[model samples]
Target: MKCPKCGKWSLMKFYICKNCGYKIDIKFEELVKRLTSENDDIFVSGMRDACSYTHSNKFYGVYAMEEAIKRKAKSENIDFYEPGFTYRSGIEYAEARSELLSLARKKGFLADVHLTQELISIWLAMYTHLDFNDLAEEIIEISKGLDEIHNFQLLYNQMHDTAVLNNNDVQRE
Candidate 1:
């Protein structure tokens, strides 16, 4: 296959073009389908491993999981349950997942399960909705009872950096 931009011929099976940084013989739709669905569990596990290894940046893993969920939802035609608001039609779940993941990437965390579940509790009198801050706090609290408390600062810094980088990328784009 040849690089469309530079017309470079190479025998490399799959690679970005070295000559002009053009991609050769690529199928974006197929790639997206595979990343989003095929062997999804493996992808999720990879993201989880990345998170575990880095220790400071779990948002990447979270984003990967979110993407997988979005893809599955889109493929299955599942609608996100937005409490109180009428369900929007023709909404692509993968896009929604991307949006949520982007939000988390910028904001530093995804909503914890409990907070996400409690979004319907209007009587709780919470002005703000559930979000990543709650999750970070929970992690910190849990670490206090374990041997991992020493590394909480690193994780916090990583979250902050990730948010900053995501925000910068958005502004630039």
Candidate 2:
């Protein structure tokens, strides 16, 4: 396909234009879904590994925790943006969290409800960090106002807990 911005003929299916640095044929929604799915898987896998290591080796647990946090931050940042800019940020995060919860249940880790809660909280905090109060409030309002919205309360609660935890952590350290 030819580049939209630049009339360049290339064999690449979807990519930034080589000639004029313009984007080629691509679907933004599809890209977001694909990325969110991949990131969710990575975050879940990292969390599982981190939890497994927590009992045997503190250092490995810490490392895995850090990696999980990084992955979560990246996923949240990519998925959470202006409403018109992206459509599936909150949905993706919620879906990912649900999947993680299922996995945790299967692995006998869901009994620690607090851990799951903390994970969601951390994700919200990271998301809010990327998007300040104004954007966050806008996003929340939009989510709440939408009739089709799901898990709005869950995400909001998580965000609240995240803020509290973050403040406490900062005070402690």
Candidate 3:
């Protein structure tokens, strides 16, 4: 059997994963079933999608988390300004996140309990970053270098333009 927590396809001789030491239990599935406000089909579909996604990717990059977000959007029937724009755009991330959270809350998602419990199932059934904050910090650090690169490219273009202007001036003289 596959280990839900670590997404490892190992021989399930125990209730815990040998690869990452994650415990398997029925509580997580129960929590998911209880907390979801949508029809069972949607919830099941979302969970299935999440599991499939995790299984395919081997639990990389917010596995079931994306499914949770997608499930919410699907249930609400809300159209995003741009689908997945927040993830790629730093400027609108916070605002878009706030809106999503508000919608989630309205749709009976209790972050401290319901959502958290559901997430545990998702985590156990998939995987999430143990060092999420550190990863975010590293991405931010790398983005600073992107600004430097952008500035250097602009500077190089200016220099090239000036050289061309100087060459034209010599031709005119």
TM-score of each: 0.23, 0.21, 0.23
Q: How are the candidates ranked when ordered by lDDT, highest leading? A: 2, 1, 3
Whose lDDT is higher: candidate 1's or candidate 2's? Answer: 2
Candidate 3 lDDT, 45-154, residue by residue in tens: 53454344333433321223332333333442322111111222343433433342342334322222233322222222222355333433443354433322222222
Tens digit of per-residue lDDT, candidate 2, span 88-170: 46655656445444533343222333444444444454365544344334433543432111122223333343334444452
All models: lDDT? 0.36, 0.38, 0.35
Winner on TM-score between 1 and 2 is 1
Clashes of each: 0, 0, 0
Q: In model 3, how many backbone clashes occur?
A: 0
Candidate 2 displacement at residue 139 in angstroms? 12
Off by over 4 Å in 1: 1-50, 75-173
Candidate RMSDs in Å, in order, are 14.3, 16.6, 21.9
